[model samples]
Target: MAMGKTPGNRDDEGDEGVFAEINITPLTDIFLVLLIIFMVTSTVIVQQGPGGGAKAGLKVNLPKGGATDVTARSTDLSVAVLADGRYVLSGNVVTTDELKAAFDKARTENPETLVIVQADEGVPHGTVVQVMELAKKAGLAQLAIGVRDGE
Candidate 1:
């Protein structure tokens, strides 16, 4: 009889607002574990440097038979062919287009620059020719090859 609503019927907003609070304990634990792992791996990261990750301050004293007077010459460029025909030049694995670009840059710097090629022994000779051809196309005419000395 009263003007107020009936007891059974309720307003639409009777319940409190919906909420979602993420539990951060597990997340914090994961972050801490990752930090520890990185700290443990820092020693390995020290091995990388500009000289291509080569080790320094360590030497091996091996028995030497004799020394030869083959003077070491400077290289202006290099190329390589893997047994699977992978092509690499100037320390970078590159496509034919990239190889050409590198050769052009190297040749432009020094017209008489030497181009040294190092290929896997298992690779076919023809594959090496293809790399050399790319070098020639980019104006690198003076090319040298590296080989193993007889033991």
Candidate 2:
């Protein structure tokens, strides 16, 4: 009897039994290729999403200016002004009245909180100013307007 062959199996040349071993090198190679393709495609898709150049909650064309780069601290807050005059605080849509409360709550938690306003280029100047004033009234002294670094 062969070590890995069926007892009743025999070949014309007297070689018997089942091969019993699976060749998986080809299957492994195919799977690895597929994994690489998926990784590349996923990265490309993410890179092409809204605010591809930077991480932003809403899609906004920032005003171009000679702005310096600023590192955001953990205590920093983000507020976005949509083109349609809507406000999005930290990715959540909020009304003008709610904006004050949100900023107040954030300020109470961290007195040194910094507010970064990210308003679309098409947004009215008055709207942006209103949000800034609200933030100030909320006791958040540190305020910063988000802009794309003209690097």
Candidate 3:
């Protein structure tokens, strides 16, 4: 019997010793793959920021707000304010005058029309206020601001 070898344990040519050391290669590979997957998914989520409904191509980072139920209705007039100071009314890029005109038209068509302003987080407060003023001047009584849902 050799040193540290038992009598019943045969050291045959085909019998390798017990694999005491753990093979970390496969574990490391799995971790790297998972890391890659997470990286890709996180980038996609960041690129596709909040508020993608109604306006498909427009990207607006809305400010966080409390939980509220705000759903789209046929009488709702949706407007978007981009960070670059551009206004989009019903998915069409428009000037301030154009937006006011659209709002007036909608209000005339439906007295109960609601104006929803979806402004980016970087937009100036004055701009948002201007939009609200436009809605008010257009005689649209109901107005709402779009905001991201959070605590």
The TM-score leader among the candidates is: 3
* lDDT tens digits, residue span 58-116, model 3: 76555667556678798899999999989998778999999889988998899899888
User: Each prediction's TM-score against the native?
Assistant: 0.49, 0.54, 0.55
lDDT of each: 0.69, 0.83, 0.82
Per-residue lDDT of candidate 2, residues 79-151 (tens digit)? 9999999999777899988888888889889988999899897999999899999989889988888887676
lDDT of 1 by residue, 1-151 (tens): 1243444556765553333445688899999999999976764564553332445325444333232423235646767777888877656678878877888888888877777777887998788888888788888888766665545
The number of clashing residue pairs in each candidate reads 0, 1, 0
* lDDT for 106 (candidate 1): 81
Off by over 4 Å in 2: 1-68
lDDT score for candidate 2 against the true structure: 0.83
Model 1 regions more than 4 Å off: 1-75
Residue pairs in candidate 3 whose N, alpha carbon or C atoms collide under 3 angstroms: none
What is the lDDT for 104 in model 1? 86
RMSD to truth, every model: 17.0, 14.8, 14.4
Model 1 TM-score (2 dp): 0.49
Which pairs of residues collide in candidate 2? 5-17
